[model samples]
Target chain A: MSTMTMAKALNAGLRRALDANPKVLLFGEDIGKLGGVFRITEGLQKDFGEERVIDAPLAESGIIGTSFGMAMRGYRPVIEIQFDGFVYPGFDQIVSQVAKFHNRTNGRSSVPMVVRIPYGGGIGAIEHHSESPEAYFVHTAGLKVVTCSNPNDAYWMIQQAVASDDPVIFLEPKRRYHDKGEVVHESKPIALHQARIVRGGTDATLIAYGPMVKTCVEAATIAEEEGRSLEVIDLRSLSPIDMVTLTHSVRRTRRAVVVHEDVRTLGVGAEVAARLGEELFYLMESPVLRVTGHDLPYPNSRVESDFLPDVDRILDAVDRSLAY
Target chain B: MSQPLQPWGGPPGATPHADAMTASDEMVQLLTPEGRRVEHPDFAFTGDDAEIAGLLREMVLARRLDLEGTSLQRQGELGLWPPLLGQEAAQIGSGRAVRDADMVFPTYREHGVAMLRGVPVGDMLALFRGTSMGDWDIDEHRFGQYQIIIGAQTLHATGYAMALQRDGLIGNPEPDRNAAVLVYHGDGASSQGDVNESYVFAASFQAPVVFFCMNNQWAISEPSTRQSRIPLYQRAWGYGFPGVRVDGNDVLAVKAVTDWAMERARQGQGPAFIEAFTYRMGAHTTSDDPTKYRLSEETEAWRRKDPIERVKTYLLDAGAIDDGWLSDLDAEADALGEHIRSTCRQLDSESLAHRFDVLFREPTAESEDDRDAHLSYLARFEPLSEESAR
Candidate 1:
């Protein structure tokens, strides 16, 4: 097991995918020489050559639209949207073409491609840079949405998403790129669509994904000092939700709090809360609560920390759930 | 071959027909609207009598199928139908130009092309009849599903061309080893962002793709003039590729032009564009009304350049087919029409479970649970008698 940052882990994972398949191609703006804005694909162009690691023109729709054609022609293309906000230009291709290729062709052709988007807020960056656009993709059927919080998952999930036959919207937590964690390359650690229980507790269940997973885990740690047991579950896959693992945790804890960096209305948290309510209606001690960003637009970076859900906000939600 | 560029924005050039009938030097023609054999400096109709007769048969059968589709829609058998009425030559000529190894990405109205690619007439109508969303085996037929979105298939064709290049299927020494991609769209689709981006990508990558745009004078209610300030083929020049306009009603010209473009792509000469200048004699679809927008005089002018009649006229004058052969083809068209009408009626809508089954290659836990839940929900009610259900 080697300790590395999420960015390095992702780079290593992408390199592994390229090495595993000759048909695997990496295409994006500035991904070739500049190695992406975050340097997540650094040294990949040099190692894989310009053919495999291609620097595409500054057109997101063209990148995805062509990638769909290549996928139809039996090539697995891994595309990178420079930022979460920039993905909108290619939104039509993603929602219309990539998402529907498999179903549209009646299972004859499936686009085994991956769209990598660096998402979420808290780095105090510019507008459109720090945004959580996972809900839009998660809401889209035929698309599998997943995000990684730590380095280990970043490594394994990147490879897994590429290996998946279905198109995957792979969200990377830009804020957590510097966070280091041990990645065991020999082991998979977990399934691509399953959620993992980061902390075991009995007082309340804290459900989160991507950047919020770290905040929820931290909340559990702080709650432990105050004689409160809060379980933290990392919802690795947003589309599938991994309800089996979530239901088990909620049934045992009897109280739940969902956390996300996305807006409170019609967000990933709402889907989790609704499902938990329907499935675990009799088992809950209190109504499911959410500790998430406000419905307003992602505020300026100066006050983003206030807008973002932190350890204090998560603990507050847990306290409210325990009180019920 | 090289005629003076027809001055744009002129007083209709004294021709009652729209833009394509101006007899410009830029446009290539093998056979004129008067059924007179014309020679082009660059391209010629190299096919013999048998090939010409075969192309004429295909155009006739396609026209018959299109009329049957319109009749069915009028009879409430179909939700809608996009008739390929006047664009028969453009479709058959370009569709036949595509070799067996090549791939084709067609817009929704390419029923004639779809039939030529070996897809049944009934299968194409199934999309309009609401029984299927095009479940044909793409790899087998080398044809993509009928793309309903305007010009999105251009990008797909470009990408597929790039894939062909990567697969070592282009610029091959052996003839059969080489492959290219053909994408069909219309004049209205030429203005789309995706189509323009496709040109950029295809040029930058030197992808082997032939962009066949049938400039049928109208995009529903809007005229082609609204879509472009110049000839549609000229758009390819700005993208660093060869572009040519052809007399769309002349089947010989379309076939020759498409053949030249496809061969260029197969030789890895980069992407090219061909504007099949024709007219949409019918409405864009059963839903549209051309009378609200276009002039009767313009439609009447184009009627003289009917794609089918010109071919029949040329073949009969050339002594390639007699009255007996024409009657036999009419009987064959009748049989095909009956087959399409019966098959469209028999096309069944697949079950919900089947839809869920095809959504993902590997079934997810959520989809499985949802399918099971739906099944149990239906199972709650007692099964009605099959006779009553029917």
Candidate 2:
């Protein structure tokens, strides 16, 4: 076991993936000698050589479209979308070509590629810097959307995402990247698509992912003192949400509340609510409620607590669900 | 037939001329505005009378398809159609010149090329009708999808050619199996970074690809003058490749140039740049109003050099195709127009249930969840039948 930050864990995970698969390549702006702006890919280019860890041109669409061609030619390219906002220039390649290559080829071609974006808000950053745009990928079909909540999961989930044959949008919480935790480096691997139950309770289930996972867990601790048991499920995989785990939790608790840092309107929470209503309708005590961010761009850091779903907001939603 | 003395940076095998005329003179027109064919010995056409008639038929059918598609867009049957009104010769000539094995990458406005490639007219309509993005398999059809982003297809073609070369399909020691790729883009697209980068890559790698630029004189509201000070094709010389200007309004000239380039590529020669100089006789698209920027006389001048009429006149003068054959071709064109109209109507009313199926080959957990949630939500309004319900 090794104690490391989420950024360090992700770096370790990338190293392991490179060691395991000779075909795995890493490419992005400043990812070679510069190690990336976050330094998550530090020393990778030197260790793996320039072919495997490429420092591509500052062209997002060029990087992505050529990577799609490379993937067609049988290479698993792990691309880093420099920032959340910078991904729009490459949106055409991602949505039109990379996302559709598999289905368009009828399984003859697969984009076994991972586009890593360091996203979400809480950092005192300028405009276009701290935005949570995971909903766009989640809304897009043929893409597997997943995000890591802590160091251990960040370490394991990245390798798993790379190993999967599907194209994955692996979102890294830019704010929580420095948070430290103990990660078990193991030979045995976990499935990439399953949700993890971070905390178990009998009252109501709190489903959160990425940066909101820690907040939901903290909310559960406060709820425990108030004699209300809150089950917190960290939805690791956003797109292929482990609905089995969610359905089972909703069945036992008979109530559900989803939490996320993204805006509330048509968010992933809405999909979860609608799905639970369809599959576990009779078992529910109340309608599925969502404790999410305001329907606005991530606000200034001074007032970000109001925009984000903190512990009190999550617990309040849990209490509201129980009252119903 | 006398070959015009080659000016500097013109096609090979000619005496270089001093003080070549301006950019306007660089538009090497072999067919006059009055529909007379001038001959250049070096770039002469060896195609028989039957081949010329066949090329004429292709240009006519391509025009008919373009007319029908534009009408569909106007009638609200299609979301948009980039009208290929006056550039029929450029598309048909270049599209037919390549071998069956050679690949083509086209911009969104290559309806004429799509027709020549035998892509079903209905399948082309799907994209404009908003029923689907593109409805053909690129590998199976040998024609790439209509890339909307300008100049991006050039890079794809370069990459495909490089892959082909790497796979020993081009530049082999036997020298018989090499293939070429014809990638199409417009004058405005020549200014984009990707297009220039593609040129650098293709030249550096000596990939078997042809850069076909249809300088249609206008890109939406921007005139050809706004795109470049010199003729677009001449820019290829800077990239270490031969470039030439052809009368894009003349089907014979277009065919002669493209055929030579494709042959060169197949013979283990590197890339060639062919600029088919033509005019856009209509608005850029259904939503565009061309009267805003273009003068009426410019349209009238190009109208006199109509590609279909030039071939028709040549055929009539030579007695290659009689009046009866012309009448039969007109009937066939009318039937094709009607077929496209009816098929477009049918497509609008038909339910596109497979829209999501092509979203992924193997459904990811997210797509599966999304599919399940969408189906259940849809079931609330329209309950599935017992036989089909899950």
Candidate 3:
């Protein structure tokens, strides 16, 4: 086991995927010589050469469309969208082409493409740089959405996503890129599209994913000190939404709080809350509460703290639910 | 009948000057507007009368399919139809250029090209009929799913071409081992960001792709002139590839250029662009009204340059097929149309219930739940089929 940051873990995963298959291609803006803005693709171009690791033109739609084409031709192309907000230009290709290609072709053709976008509002950046666009992707049908909270998940999930036949929207928690953690690289990685219970408890379940998972875990520990045993569920997959694990946690706790940086309205949190209400209606001590960003344009980084949900916000939701 | 007798792309009220042919990279034409064979300096139609007749025959069949599709839409049998009324030769010529191994990525209106790609007339109408996008399983066909979004497939084709390049399919010692990609778009789509980006990537990577832009006078309601200040083909020069403007109405000219271009790509010469200068002789689709946006005089002018009409005229002029033969071909085309009508009618109305079936290679737990929920909801109504309830 090596102590590595999420960035290094992802880099290692990309290396392994490249080493595993010659047909696997890497394409994005500044991914080649620059090794991606986050350097997650560092040393890959140098190792794999220019053909395998491509520095594509600065066009999101082109990156996706071409990747979809490459996938059609039996090549697995992993594309980087550079940033969360930048993916909008290629959203049409993602929703219209990448997602639907498999369904339209009756599962005969699949876009085995991975789109990695560094997401969420932290690291004190500009408007477009810091934004949570995962909600939009989770809404799309033909794609799978996943995120990594720590180094191990980052290392393992990147490899799993690349190897997947379905198109995957890999949302990187840009804020936690430097957070160090122990990574265990095994012969086989953990199952994708399944949620893992990071912490177990019976009072209430704190559900979150990607950037919010770390935050929720911290919130659970703080909640423990407050005399409430909180279960923290790190939802790795958003689309299929590891509901089996989520239901187990919610059923045990009988109360839940969904937390995320995405806007509260029709967000991932809202979907979780809706599902819980449907499944655990009689067992619930209270309605599923949500602690999320306000429904407004992601503000400039100076005021981002005011917009982002934090430990205090999670505790407040926990308090509100316990009162019920 | 086409006002002032001036062919398009020239000065108003003037036939394309004889100097026009010699002026630029002369558009290679094997058949002229007058139905006479012409000799070109660079390209020639090497096909025998039988093969040439096949081209004409396919064009007629495609045109008949298009007419039947339009008629079907008018009679409420279809929701919409994007008629390829004038761009038959451009599609057929380029469609024929690709080998069985080579792939095609075409924009939505390439009905002729789709027909050549092994999708039948009725299967193609499945899109217009609101049954499915296209009836043929897109995975099984050499052609891609008909992309409605303009200029998007150009990049996809280039991506596929890039793969072809990396696979060492291009420049293979064995001719049959080599393969390339041909993508179709239009003048208006040239202005799209995706189309331009596709060019950049294809040129940068030296992808074996041919961008066949049917500059069919109008892009829906907007004119081609509004889309490009200079001739469209020259735009390829800016992207670092050889580009040509071919006679879209001249089947031989299109086939020759496309063939040469695809061969050039397989030889690792990078991508090639061809602007098939034609006209939209009919409305863009069943929903569009040409009278609102264009003049009838202009339509009359384009009708004179009709691709199928010119091919028929050429065949008759060469005594390739007599009136009796032409009539027999028409009878066959009508029979095909009848088959399409019957096939469209026979398609199960509730086929959309199987929407969840093709969603994934294997159904995910969530998708399975969704399917169950949907089926349960449908069962609340009188179960259309006894098996649908479970």
Candidate 4:
């Protein structure tokens, strides 16, 4: 086991996937020489050669559209979206072609490609870069949406995603890119779609994913100090959510609070809340609550901290759930 | 015959040169409208009598299938049919140009190309018949699903070409070893952003692909002029590739140009574009009405240049086929039409549960639970009671 940042772990993971399979290719804008804007694919172009590590044109639609083709050609293409908001240009190809290729052909063919996007906001950045677009993709069927919150998961999940035959929308927590953690390169802690319980407690269940996983863990620590025990569950996969794990935790705790960086209404938190309410309705002691970003466009960087759901907002929701 | 739509800012008829139908000076025509062979400075008509007869047979059979499809739609057997009525030469000539190893990415209307790729006529009609999305195996036939979204397949074709490049399939001296990609779209699709971006990616990567645009003169209610101010083929020059416009009704010329383009790609000459200057003599699909937009006079003019008629005329004038052979070919077409009619009705209507089966390689818990719930709900309806059934 070695200690590394999430970004380095992701780089290592990409290198490992390239080494393991010759058919695996990396396609994106500025990912080659520049090593991606976040440096997640740094040094891969030199190691894997330009043929595998392709620097595509600035057009996002072209990047995704062609990647779908390469996938059809039997190549496992891993595409990188430069930013969360820039993915809109390629949205049509993703929803129309990539999402439907398998069902459209009646299971005869599939585009076994991975589209990686560093999402969520914490550090001060301009508009479009800091938006959370997971809800849009999670609403789409035939796409497996996942996010890694730490170095350990960043290393293992990237490999697991590349190994899967279905298309994965791998969302990386941009705020956690530089966060260091012990990563065992030998094996993954959990499967790609399973949820991980970070901090186990019995009072109230805190459901979070992506960047908010780290925040939930922090909130759990603070709640412990205030004589409240919070069970923090990191939801690895957003689309095919591990409802079994969630139902088990919420069933025991009897209360739940869902959190995320995306907006309040119609967010992933809404789905989690609704599912928890459905599964644990008779068993639960209180109603499922949500502590999420406000239902507004990502505000200016100066006010982003105020707009985002921090530990205090999470604790307040936890307090409310406990009050009920 | 199409009256020139006034150029973007210019007066009407001022850009008559832009009219694809009348702009014949730049087109490569090996077979004239009168069934006479003409000498071209660039392309050569190298087919012998047997090869020419083979082209005629395929074109006749393809047209027969198309006519059957139209009749079926009218007879309420099909939901819709996109007729390739006047573009037979463009479809047949280009469809026969590439080897079986080369991949084809066709728009929804390329039924002729699909037939050449070995996709059964019934399987192609299944999409229209609402029996299934498409049941044919794309990889087995080296053809992609018939993309309904306009021009989206171009990007897939370009990317597949790039894959060929990475696999070292291009620039092979051995002719049989090298392979490329052939993508077909219409003039209306030329205005799509994805189509232009495909050119950028193909040129940038030097991907082996041939962009075959069948300029069918009309895009539903809009004329070809609505899609382009300049000729559609000339757009390739801006992206640093060679583009050629051929007389789409001339089978010999379309085949020759597509062969050259595919050869250039296989030889690592990057991408090439071929604009088959043709006409869509029928409505865009069964639901459309040509009388709502285009004039019959224009349709009459294109009728004189009928692709199949010209090929049949050429064969007769050259003594390549006799009346007996024509009757035999007609009988073959009749048999094929009958086969399609029978097979289309026999297509299995898949169960809704089949959707959960194919939605993912491995079903997630959510999908599984949903499927179970759906099945249980369906099971709640008791099997028809004996008395009720009677």
Candidate 3 chain B lDDT trough over 10 residues, lowest sum: B14-23
Residues B321-373 of candidate 3: C-alpha lDDT, one tens digit per residue: 89998999989998989987887776543355577776766457888888888
TM-score of the second chain of model 4 compared to its true counterpart = 0.93
lDDT of 4: 0.89
Estimate, for each residue in B1-390, the C-alpha lDDT of model 4 and write its tens digit: 756544322345454323232333378999888888889877887888789789889989889889988999998999999999888899999999989889999998888889999998778999999989976899889988888889999999999999999889999989888999999999999999999999999989989999999999998898999998888876776676778889999999999989989988998988988999999988899999999898899999999998888778888988889999999999999999999999878876688888887887766878888888999988866564544787
Local error of candidate 1 at residue A315 (angstroms)? 1.4
Candidate 2 residue lDDT tens string, A278-303: 89998899999998889987787788
Of 1 and 3, the candidate ahead on lDDT is 1
RMSD in angstroms between candidate 1 and the native structure over all alpha carbons: 4.3
As for candidate 4, its clashing pairs are: none
Query: What tens-digit string does per-residue lDDT give for candidate 3 at A60-172?
Result: 88889988888888899999989999999999999988888778765567788999999998789977988888888889887899998999999999988998989899999
- Considering only N, C-alpha and C atoms within 3 Å, which residue pairs clash in candidate 2? A239-B366, A240-B365, A240-B366
TM-score of 4: 0.96
lDDT of 3 at A281: 96
Q: Which pairs in model 1 have colliding backbones?
A: B3-B25
* Candidate 3 global Cα RMSD: 4.9
**Worst 10 contiguous positions by lDDT, candidate 3 chain A:** A101-110
Number of clashes found in candidate 1: 1
| Global lDDT scores for all candidate models | 0.89, 0.82, 0.86, 0.89
Assess the local accuracy of residue B45 in candidate 1 as a C-alpha lDDT between 0 and 100.
91
